[model samples]
Target: MLQLQVPCSWYFWALAFGFNLAMHNLKNILISVVIVSNLGKIIRTCTCLYKQDSTEHHDHIE
Candidate 1:
């Protein structure tokens, strides 16, 4: 019984370890995606504001 149990326990531990590693990697990927999307949004907004400002400046000169 003891001999049988040891191998089973080891298999269970290995499965759990693999699962934990996969979840950790998935979390990091999700975080990076969110950060990149937010950065893109911020850049777009800044570009729009800059364009508007330049247009207004040109209007004033005219």
Candidate 2:
């Protein structure tokens, strides 16, 4: 009774849906990490440069 109950297209559809969902989730996660990491690096570098410039400016005035 169970052998004939399942349809052939049902498995294909289920697999395709699951694959699509997995790919979408993976893509979103990759993009988020890349953006966050790059932004953090940029902010840190800017802060370092600002501090160095201010220190140099104060030394030149003395």
Candidate 3:
């Protein structure tokens, strides 16, 4: 009969690889979310300014 044992070092390497992958993915997600949120804010601000400018123009004509 032959018995085989798994090495502990293999588990250590696997843990390190998983940790690195998770950190990299998290960083990418955070960056994309921040960019999207900022873009939305910019668009909203522009629209508000345009609306105000248009209202002022209409009042001047009246």
Candidate 4:
């Protein structure tokens, strides 16, 4: 009975540790994903604005 108890407690502790690690990693992944998406949106908007500005300038020169 004592031997069985030791392994059972070890397993429980291992499971808890793994769960905590998974949650931490999940949070980091979500944060990175949000940052990347926002960056992509900003870049796309900037490119569109630059294109419009250049085209307008070209028309004015002509």
When sorted by lDDT, best at the front, the candidate numbers are 4, 1, 2, 3
TM-score of each: 0.60, 0.57, 0.57, 0.60
**Model 1 segments beyond 4 Å from truth?**
1-22
**All models, RMSD in angstroms:** 7.4, 6.7, 6.6, 6.0
Poorest 10 consecutive residues of model 4 by lDDT? Answer: 20-29
lDDT for 44 in candidate 3 is: 100
Worst 10 residues of 1 by lDDT: 20-29
Could you give candidate 2's per-residue lDDT for residues 1-62 as a string of tens digits?
Answer: 56555765678788999898878799888999999999999999999999999999999998
lDDT: the better of candidates 1 and 2: 1
lDDT of 4: 0.96
lDDT of 3: 0.87
Per-candidate local distance difference test? 0.95, 0.89, 0.87, 0.96
| Per-residue lDDT of model 4, residues 1-62, tens digit only | 99999999999999999998878799888999999999999999999999999999999999
- Which regions of candidate 3 deviate over 4 angstroms? 1-22
Clashing pairs in 1: none
